[model samples]
Target: MTTAYYVHVTIDQGKNVMLLDSGCTQSAFPLKEFQKLLFQFGTQKISHQFIIADIDNAILLRLDFFENHHCLLDFQNAQLKIRDSAVRCCDSQGNLLKVNVQVRQDTVLPPRTERFSMARLSTKWVQGTACIEPADTVPGVLVATTVQDPDKQQVHLRLMNYTDREIRIPAGKIVAMCLAANLTRPAPTESASHGQLPEHLKTLVEESCQGFSPEEKPKVQALITEHQNAFSSSQYDFSKTNVIKHGIPLVPGAKPLKQRPYRHGTAQEAEIEKQGQSLIREGHGA
Candidate 1:
């Protein structure tokens, strides 16, 4: 009989939250969220080899080395400067259809306008199609990106004016929703059954362990020996204890103390009492 062990890990990269799935043959990420990491994907060949689709039909991409990684989100697009202008359309007889390009007075343009806003994305694959939408319910339109030219960071976006009123897109507005089609493939495996780790991965794990320092090797071995039961056993018992009842002890002779009235305080008190007696003789206590 073989005992299978699985562990769950929560990965948070800025606003992105992902989980470590053991049943999943490979790891996966949302394209929009993936772009926010300080990591880059490897060439498609290496990626395609390791990142196959899981049973759920989601394609899993593995992370390459973590060095000199770059984020793909467009922080500059948080606030875009919208300038107002007029576009004149003339009829055959030079009759102009004048529509003022309405710009909101509160709208502020960025200092530089020669270059349009662009969005960068990251992926291990050479090229693939993705669906881009607006994050919020707004009039901002996506100019769109080509699935053919998803170079390292060449994905650019253009905003189209859909509404008649020229308005300002406030800063920090999340306006891009990009999603890639589900890449489906078989999970990496050596045999049909699921209890064993992939052969390639087993080799890599062995190599990694072999490369550990001499002092660290014993620590790793100790951890494995200590947690051997966790890997070999499938049953876990969590018997609840009578926590509240057993927490504090009841003392038999406990009693509440009573307050006492003021008595002898000082010589000043005795002198005051004598003065009070004299005053009472005179029919006055003050």
Candidate 2:
């Protein structure tokens, strides 16, 4: 938001207001008002000329005695003080049309003045697109078995770090979770109603499976098993390479939750957690 104030000026015996906006980069007068004033004053003659920002223009009339003449302008309530200033008129193609003498006002005031403290005007222009969805139902992560439609079945995974450290989850890890969840076939001993991964994702899962190291195969397999049981289970936890863990559920609409009080189970646990948290705050450890 930005604001600018202009003083009164008379054209053709009628009052018109002029606002100087440097952002415009050109002098402009209201075309309709200018025409009306010209008709009323019946003056095509030029009175004075001056330069404004290196452009020359003519000032045919001055309206300094606005109050005495009973002429009203757009910013009638504007308090004005006169100083030396000038303006120039230009055409659409940037050609210099004419110059006009303008009176400048010292808008700056002393620090203690009440007018300086109290006088203010503001204007705001909102400038953005709205993409916000209902807070209650936004998904934090997508799972392979989770249906894509908002009205259908969806899995909301909550993640947290209660260990007094910052954790980074690599993109590869998330991709692996998706692939593993899609690849696992139902055991013969399990029920037949459990859904299988779509055929389109089989090739992707196979390719991703080949990229896992020997040590990672067990973890991937475990994640698949846990995901299958996640709906019925109370909670799940998994560690990441960056010392952070995932699979914790975020409370719905819980962003405004306040910080929990520090719990000290024992003196030793309290000291260790305190020191660890301080180090994490200092960026020394995850």
Candidate 3:
């Protein structure tokens, strides 16, 4: 039989110890343990209801685990922050705008910094939404969009202020939380070049692309659409394109150097060259 080695990670918030299984396909925590820690340290929303289910189509009953929660754990000089709050947008004054955030079930929370990464706590994908609630207390709702980074490992949230007055968001208080909404299985994605479509067009593409073949036709069409959206080249149309095409204009003091004959250098020159070679070998040459 093969030997199994496991690493234990401690979560200081609830004094919970989690097992890190390298051989396992996905990370997970016991339901009882999850509930215990969540109750002790996590914030729950009594107004919101969340339903968690299992792969066998059985509803894994859970207590109210809706409101945003943050539990920070430090490991090896890296911070592993756990929370349901995926999007946190603030202004220069540290004020967050109350806005509705809709994201895919597989959306991972954005990292705090380059050094930080999301801890593999569970394999289960959870979908959620912080629905648009009446914000009469605040001036107005801020419009926001969630953007994923080029690497696809990171995501960014950009919020635009719409109201005249500034809204002050208090520390540790969530203006809106990313709530669990739905669970989805992995499926073939659209054209790789065009990742996620704009919200308005996304719906249209989804509805229309359903009938189109995912392999060949859609990919070609998406390529065509992207090329069509590109900016038109002005050089071909501008009359001044050929006016300065041949050669660049020279500055007043700029003169081309004439080739100099190679000559034997003096002792000082040889010493300087030796020092230069030493510097280059030392990896400090410019």
Task: Report the number of the highest-lDDT candidate.
Answer: 1
Shift of residue 100 alpha carbon in model 1, Å: 33
lDDT against the true structure, each candidate = 0.36, 0.32, 0.32
Candidate 2 TM-score, true structure as reference:
0.16
Runs in model 3 deviating more than 4 A are: 1-138, 145-155, 179-286
**Residue-wise lDDT of candidate 3 within 142-218, one digit each (tens)?**
32322221122112333233444554433222223222222333452353245544333444455556666668657
TM-score of each: 0.22, 0.16, 0.20
CA lDDT, candidate 2, residue 136: 20
Which digits, one per residue and each the tens of the lDDT, describe model 2 over residues 132-172? 11112112321122211111111222332233333333321
Output the TM-score of candidate 3: 0.20
Off by over 4 Å in 2: 32-286
Clashes of each: 1, 7, 5
Supply candidate 2's per-residue lDDT for 124: 17
Error of 2 at 37 (Å): 9.9
The model with the greatest TM-score is 1
Tell me the tens digit of each residue's lDDT in model 1 across 170-202: 543444544443344445333323344433334
Candidate 1: count the clashes.
Answer: 1
Residue 145 lDDT (model 3): 23
Q: List the residue pairs that clash in candidate 1.
A: 81-109
Better of 1 and 3 by TM-score: 1
Residue 145 lDDT (model 2): 22
